[model samples]
Target chain A: AQTIHQWPVAEIKAVGSPLSLGCTIKGKSSPNLYWYWQATGGTLQQLFYSITVGQVESVVQLNLSASRPKDDQFILSTEKLLLSHSGFYLCAWSPTGVEQYFGPGTRLTVL
Target chain B: QQQVRQSPQSLTVWEGETAILNCSYEDSTFNYFPWYQQFPGEGPALLISIRSVSDKKEDGRFTIFFNKREKKLSLHITDSQPGDSATYFCAASAGGTNTGKLTFGDGTVLTVKP
Candidate 1:
């Protein structure tokens, strides 16, 4: 079975603060990883996706970046938080295109 | 282009009644359509999915109907229950991409009443 884990389930940060959200997947190697943001009552917006280590692609530029430091780890980071960046962040991995498995999302509130 | 669009921002259904959610897409390249169910704080789960080559797919109480030419799809939940209340999202994707990125719909909130 495959399992995905995310850290700091919830966080509150002030504007201009740095932020980092981490995710790790087990039981899968070199799986496709993605970072998505969901605003209040909004759809899931894909921010970034990575297929291999040390390679990442940005789909939407919300002033955030992502890095694939390891085969099973992907991170989303920002040097300065924007008030509009506040939302529920979700990390997902897919072994195949048929379905995607997601971790418990990280709820961030930027004041 | 907002590849996908879901109807009825919210829905209310009586217990044991059927709840239907509609989704349509503008992109013809989309080969996969999936319906995801999400609780208030959790990530969306794959409730059911249908491929472009097939007209329908079913899993237990959940059924997905697909119209390839119309580029429309719907999710029908039989015998709704209070536990089934959640936000349902419609997602579309192409298969050839290695990134496995999905285009998602805004979502519809379903409330099952007893």
Candidate 2:
């Protein structure tokens, strides 16, 4: 079985503050990891994806960065948060990069 | 641009009734379609999916009817129940050849009355 875990299930931060969200995958080796953002009740937007360690690709410009430091971990971070960065952050993993399994998710609120 | 679109921003159905959710894509390059079901405060789950090569895909009570020519698809939930109430998102991707970057629709909220 595969398990995806995200840290700090929810966060409330002020604008311009730095933010970091982490995701870890267990029981699956070398799985593709992806980060997505969604507004409250809105469609999901793909932010970034990592096919291998030390290699990350950005799909859309969301003022955020992602890193795959280890085969089992993917991290999303931002130097400075904007008001528009508030929303739900989701981490997903896929073996074939087509059928994906999503994590529980992290809710972010920027004031 | 919103490449993927869903119809009937909201829908309501009774128990044992059938609920139909519609979706369409504007991009011709999109060849993969997947439907996701999301509950409040949770990540969306892959409900069912259909490739452009196939017109229909069924899994138990959930079925996907696709029309490649029309660039449209519909999700039919038969024997609907209150537990089936949630937001369904229609998503599209280019193909399996590239990284899976899915374009999502706004989503349709389905309410099932017991």
Best by DockQ: 1
The most accurate candidate by lDDT is 2
Model 1 misplacement above 4 A: none
Residue runs of model 2 more than 4 Å from their true location after superposition: none
- Cα miss at A89, model 2 (Å)? 0.2
Candidate 1 lDDT, A1-101, residue by residue in tens? 88999988999999999999999999999898999999977899989988899999999999999999999999999999999999999999988645787
Task: List pairs with backbone clashes in candidate 2.
Answer: none
Q: Please give the TM-score that candidate 1 achieves against the real structure.
A: 0.98
Clashes of each: 0, 0
lDDT, candidate 1, at A80: 100
What TM-score would every model get versus the actual structure?
A: 0.98, 0.98
Looking at candidate 1 chain B, the ten consecutive residues that score lowest on lDDT are: B93-102
Interface RMSD of every predicted model, in angstroms: 1.3, 1.1
Q: In angstroms, how far off is A20's CA in candidate 1?
A: 0.6
CAPRI category for model 2? medium
What is the RMSD of candidate 2?
0.9
